[model samples]
Target: FWDILEQPPGSYPEIEKQYFGTHVSLTTDIAGDYLIKLTVSDGYSVVSDTVTVSFYYENVAPSVETISAVYAIQDQTVPLDGSGSYDPNGDVMTYQWFFVSKPKGSNAVIDDPLAEVTSFYVDVPGIYAVSLAVSDGELEGKPYNPFYVKAFSLLGAHTKLLVNEDIEPQLLPYKERFVVDKTLTDDEVAKEYVLGRYTIEAVGKDVTISNISATDHLNLIKPYFRGWSENEIVVVKKGESLTFELVSPPTNGKLTDLSFSFAWSLNGVGDFSMQERFSAGYDFTSR
Candidate 1:
């Protein structure tokens, strides 16, 4: 059995006691000093003792680490991550994200403001500043620096043609042209491929072209080259060929011409330099 000899000067939960037992339990809803007296009897004699119980509540703010910068394409969803936040007292945290700045006349909004990992759509091509604050139900911690997201537009041209329907189906021929707006050093021009073209021929299909060893400025300067066919599958009869042309600026120098002529069908791509040529072939039939 037990008795509350003294307690803080406030209303609290009722103490739970078992009269037939030797001990009692007390639970207090309010935090403060509590005085309890316990009396125990063994059918012969009784003894009493007093004890003081103390309860304290203290909360510490949490810390957060957010992304510094993010680059994304315009008209796309940009993801923001703040899962690195943590409470020093090991408390469960809640997230609150908001935008500090955005492009003028933009109406972008976060998908979920209270999510640790959230996303927002980029409506315009500009910089968007976002901020995150995390709370441990008691204290909130805001980031020192706002997160930045830069959205940019992609500019390019694409043309699709059928072998016998789009144009005369002679050896499928394509041409590409490029203009350099910024000046670049010779090493920079050599390290990157400013243009790429690809010609995909079906398996067991034969393609023929005149002048198998024709050399052009593309073979001499050997600007970078990468090629890919359209997503749709293309079927061509024997003696038919497919051609593609991709062009991009390399430097501010004079305009450069690139061309290739081969008698056999190429199944893959190749990288060429002044010293060596590296090529990889992919069998489309396996795909």
Candidate 2:
């Protein structure tokens, strides 16, 4: 018999035991920690053992989080982030950014595809498709669906459209863009929520994001693994804290919730554009 320590005794929903008597297959929408106890006894003797399980059920592929459209000055170096990519096995490791397409007649290119963090310089005014792929080391992960980053003539335009891009697919930056594919949690601490932040460069100019707040209603699903099987499937669940800051605080500040976008106009180009990109939540321990 099995039981969840936090749940009423005998409240363990029936689950199929795996090949090993020590392991079991759980089929439930619930996600969290469980402490299972096993006891065996003959008429004359008895013995017992216990195991604590930090469990979460998720069914998903590695995903990338990022801004939809990026704006940069032609011929100038620009950073791209792919660090937001994630895997369930705590396996996702390396980040690889690619350009699905380049502007016609453009000679722009990403500095290094293998490097976790990289940059690029575009010399033409056109839309380019940029994508990111992650690896769990043993296997390569999926690339974020590609997004476009517009480039304008460096000396010609002081301001340009700040395209309202979606944060679905992040590439791989600083005031400089950032891809926090890494997840850090403090389970030791008993805190209600976990907060996170990222640095975003103002699209049209070199302004500083010293202190600003934003919200990301991004649909982030947390993933978890079971057993030690190399080929085992991953479990996923929709959860985690949203509403992060635009810029990582130089110091800690109580997190606040709000939905907004950053608006800016280019110098020579008088069109206005808005974008809202936020950092991922650090804690994934199902609420």
Candidate 3:
């Protein structure tokens, strides 16, 4: 478009300015229908063009919202999410996650700092702080609310089952009586069998001992950890050794030369099975 001025219309020469490359800044204290032009210079040649910035509009800034806190167990994989953040102007946003604070001496790292959902693991128990930032095409929002994380420890667990020895022989298949019994005065050595039992010790905190079962009640027995306990859950705490006793859960005592084995399991942070075995029968030679 051409405008009329005091100077010759062709002689006003379309007020022009040269920009070295792709961009040029135009500042105007006075706004009106003024002519502005752009030109580029290479060592060998020149190129130029013109465009208009309408006086009616302006650019606006964007903002982000606050995130909440979390609590979890130590040695656990925890998630830090920034998907709650939103841009007011409906501009597409990108996210950046960071570990602003962690346990002392902690070198824990977020699995992916640039992702909307990142994760980290802390073996040390303590409070931590994580932060997130949202970016519009032009600028990043400032001072976002950080997420506070609380990590706590899990108690350790241990178990032990042992066979008891060093007592009267247990392989008593049948009760025996002495031959010295007479009508005047009956003399007899009473035949009896005492089956020995084992004690299973459960040690740990927030722990349960269940699934107690035995391979055999009469022979080759490691206590059955497969089916025992009420609903198979027993809470055992650290420094507290919970012991359960099994005295041959009422089987035929006459089943001689039998080996009995019992076994059970423990879980959480660690997995283990406790086992023990002992034999029983009648010692006929002693008769």
| Cα lDDT computed for each candidate against the true fold | 0.55, 0.47, 0.47
Candidate 2 vs candidate 3: the TM-score winner is 2
Q: Name the lDDT value of residue 66 in candidate 3.
A: 43
Position 169, candidate 1: lDDT: 16
Q: Taking the tens digit of each residue's C-alpha lDDT, what string does model 2 give over 164-196?
A: 233322332112322332124433333222233
Error of 3 at 228 (Å): 26
Best by TM-score: 2
Instruction: Flag the better candidate by TM-score, 1 or 3.
Output: 1
Question: Which regions of candidate 1 deviate over 4 angstroms?
Answer: 1-57, 155-287
- State the lDDT at 163 in candidate 3: 38
Sorted by TM-score (best first), the order is: 2, 1, 3
Question: How many clashing pairs per prediction, in order?
Answer: 1, 20, 36
The residue-by-residue lDDT of candidate 1 on 80-114, one tens digit each, is 88988889878999999999999887899999999
TM-scores, all models, native as reference: 0.37, 0.41, 0.35
- Summing lDDT over every window of 10 consecutive residues in candidate 2, give the lowest-scoring window: 233-242
lDDT of model number 1: 0.55
